[model samples]
Target: MNWFMEFLATGFYSGKLPKMPGTWGSIFAAVLAYFLWPSNPDFQVLVILITFFLSVVSSDYLARKLGDKDPDQVVIDEVLGVEITFFLLNPQGDLELTLAGLILFRIIDIMKPFPIRLFERLPGGWGITVDDAVAGVLANILLRVIGGFL
Candidate 1:
């Protein structure tokens, strides 16, 4: 059970990579989103919501196990964030849009603007997960706004 939790918390070992584990996890998720994301928006939302729930649980468990506040190696949050980004901006799996979303999400996540950073103050899995989700939502909105101008 710990092994399985660790596997999930680490984003299938992407988090164990040399550096920027969150970026790697998001990249992995983007690839999966490009290749396998469903077409229906309802299903897309469903998937995102399910991933969100799992990410909270997995990240919470891993954080407690590691005795860290938002451990660098726990990147299920990144996976969920990237999935949310794709769901909003590239639900049809457009490679270009998905790439754009990936970049935007990474940037917003790193920058941690305003309330995004605030979400991290929450307890347990909520802290680990909600910040990235907020970043994803912001990235999605930012991308859409940018696309409107282009």
Candidate 2:
């Protein structure tokens, strides 16, 4: 159980990287989304929502063991963020669009502008998951708007 939590918290070990674990986790999420993305919008929404809920549980439990509000190595939040960002845009297998979404989501997550930062303090895994979820929502809107122009 402990190792399983660590595995999940580490975003399948992408978070174990020496630097920028969140970024690595996001990258992993992007690759996963590219390969396994669903064609149906309903399914995409379902998958991301489930991932978010599971991440919240595992992340909160692991955060408790680590004695940190949000440990750097706990990056399932990154996975949730990336999944949410890609859910509505239909980026799927499009390399350029997926890359753009990844970049945008990471920037917003890293910067945590406006309410993004506020969501980080929501308590337990809710805090850990939502900040990045907000970033994902922002990235999704931007990606949709920009993808329309290009």
Candidate 3:
């Protein structure tokens, strides 16, 4: 079952699991966030912040061990990024906001704007994960601003 563990850890089977692994991972993370988010807004914000930070650090290492430059199979970064976006919006479990946040995270991640492209140049798994994290941060700020106005 060693192979199975590697497959699961690397998310290699993610492609056959239904939706794109990146998207599916994000959805799964969001569900987790929904359950973990505290009733107190301050605590929820703290949880999001900590989750984003840990996701970046851990995914970086995991990507390197799994090999491949930004492997499609490694999607925890996407999960964390989408979680960061939705958390910033403070959606109160609104499905519309969740969908929008997912779209926004995916778009920004694909676009790789500005410093995000620069971050990708860093060596190893840091290169793999940092760019996406930056994209997530940017998307989070934009969503927060938009949420403020609405």
Off by over 4 Å in 3: 1-19, 39-66
- Stretches of model 1 off by over 4 angstroms after superposition: 91-93
Expressed as tens digits, the lDDT of each residue in 24-101 for candidate 3 is 666665565555545566775776566555555555565666666666666666665766676535555766666667
TM-score on alpha carbons, each prediction? 0.95, 0.96, 0.71
- Candidate 3 clashing pairs? none
Please provide, for model 2 over 59-81, each residue's C-alpha lDDT reduced to its tens digit, 9 standing for 90 to 100: 99989998999999999999999
**If ranked by lDDT, best first, what sequence of candidates would result?**
2, 1, 3
Report model 1's TM-score to 2 decimal places. Answer: 0.95
Backbone clash total, candidate 1: 0
Give the distance in Å from residue 52's predicted Cα in candidate 2 to where it truly belongs. 1.0
Worst 10 residues of 2 by lDDT: 84-93
How much does each candidate deviate from the true structure in C-alpha RMSD? 1.2, 1.0, 3.7
TM-score top scorer = 2
Local distance difference test values of all predictions, in order: 0.89, 0.89, 0.64
